[model samples]
Target chain A: MGLEIINTLILLLLVVAALVALRVKDLITASVVFGVYSFLMCLLWAEMGAVDVAFTEATVGAGISTVVLVATIFNLKRKSSD
Target chain B: MKNTSLIPVVLVGFLLFYASTDFPEWGDPQSPASSSPVSSHFIAKTGVDTEVPNMVTAVLADYRGFDTMLETVVVFIAGMAVLAILRNFSRKKPVKRGHEVSVEPDLIVTNTVRLVVPVIQIFSFYVLAHGHVSPGGGFQGGVLMGASFILIALSWDLERALTRFPINRCMVVAALGILLYAGIGVLSMALGGEFLDYAELEKVLPVSREMARYHAMLGVEIGVGFTVTAIMFALYANLSSRGRLEGGL
Candidate 1:
């Protein structure tokens, strides 16, 4: 019961973080927040017992996808007017 | 690109959420994944036939060996694609070194990182070698190994690290790995069984069926590891180069 409560709280936090990311003006911070969102989703997948999918999400989603997106952002001109 | 377009994205997100409603609850023992015919067959036969502790390996290398072989070719193709892209468009001149930056503070950190990097590399090798017996496998180990270089690039400059492990050489090794895997498959076919059938190789070698299967799996796994590591490294190099160019560093 306690574990269930924690999982629900974590999922709620992830949704909130993702919304914040979408609303943020700074593209870089938003990208980082999205990466955090991916990490949390991987944890949720693990909690749901899809270990294989969780593993792929943790590696590809959190690691490779984040790096690629961040690198692409770095190549673009930074602006506060997102 | 507009807020209006995001309506579709929002709808897709909600659709995914709704789809999850039909999924079994977390850790339900009676889930189809746990009780499926394929999983059951693997669990029952893997131990008796393969003598391998890792059931994933038995399924990947024995039951679906053909799929694994083609997956290796896909990885090799990806590596080649990166190499082609880099060769076609990268700047010809070496990136100019700017005015001397302060090295004293960063020196200590770099030295410490350099010390730990080799240990991480060793651990990746251990993961690759023990994949047949453990939870981890070639893809996981290969990424871990590639990540060590990324750390080196972060602590030190990308240029210095690129000097030690040239992207071109990584590409060559990746292609060679695929060739080696295909050679094994062809050898199996020549010995009278269908392609990638390790049981046919048993007639030529003095080893048991289990050992032959293990050997074949190791060959393909090493190929996968090489191809994935090389392609990942290539992607990082290209992305970082683009970053440096746009950032004017």
Candidate 2:
């Protein structure tokens, strides 16, 4: 029950972080925050016993997607105003 | 950037919440996944037929071999796409204007990353090699291996790094990997029992069927690993090196 409560809290925090990411003006920081959101989602998946999907999400989402997005940032100009 | 869509967002969230209600309880041993016909078959026959310790690998290499082959093709296509994009645009001269300085330090903190990279690479190989008896497999290990190169790229100059590992060679290796996988399948057909049937190869190779299957699976896994690792690094290189040349402006 304690673990369940903690998981719920963590999920709530992730939702808040995602909202912040979406509302943020800086594209790069927002992308990084989105990556963090993906990682938190992976944890939620694992907690739900979807181990295989969680594994894919953690690797592809946190690892590959982050690298790709960071790389993409090099090609674009920084600081987009909302 | 600040378009209001609160109703749609709330509706989507509610729909997702509703869908979660139908899902099985977390970690319930008697959940449908554990009790399903497919899982039951896997649990029962995996040891009897494959004799391999890892059930996930048995399913991936033996039962779902066709899907694995197509996945290798997808990796090959990604490598080709990266090469095409990089060759056309990446090699073009950067438009020079004035003095631009890097915010990040050019030199790494120490040799720690360099020292750890080989260890990580070795672990990835171990994961790929022991996949038959372990949880890791071609796809997982392949990405881990690819990450080593990305690390190197991060800590070093892109121009010098490209010289050490050219994108064109990576593309060739990726293509070769897919072809090698198909070649093995064709070789199996030539030996007798349809394409990709390892049992037939066992009969021709004078080895036990189980051992032959193990060897064949290893071959395909290596192919997948190489193709995936190469393609992933290629994409990383192309994406990271845009607008930068051999020497900084």
**Candidate maximizing lDDT:** 2
Error of 2 at B124 (Å): 1.3
**Residue B227 displacement in candidate 2 (angstroms):** 0.8
Which pairs clash in the backbone of model 2? none
lDDT of 1 at B90: 43
Q: Could you tell me the lDDT of residue B227 within candidate 2?
A: 88
Interface RMSD of 1: 6.0
DockQ per candidate: 0.28, 0.34
Candidate 2 off by > 4 Å: A1-10, A45-62, A78-82, B1-34, B89-92, B97-106, B204-206, B243-249
Return the lDDT, model 2, position B36: 93
Model 2 chain B lDDT-worst window of ten: B240-249
Proportion of the native interface contacts kept in model 1: 0.14
Cα deviation in Å at residue B104, candidate 2? 8.4
In the range B1-249, model 2's lDDT, one tens digit per residue, is 344677788899999999999998766768999899999999998877767777878888877887899988987887677556654454556654333344354545327668878987898898789888856677767787777777777676565556767777887878877887777788888988778887667866777887777778888888888888888887787776542423321
lDDT of 2 at B222: 87
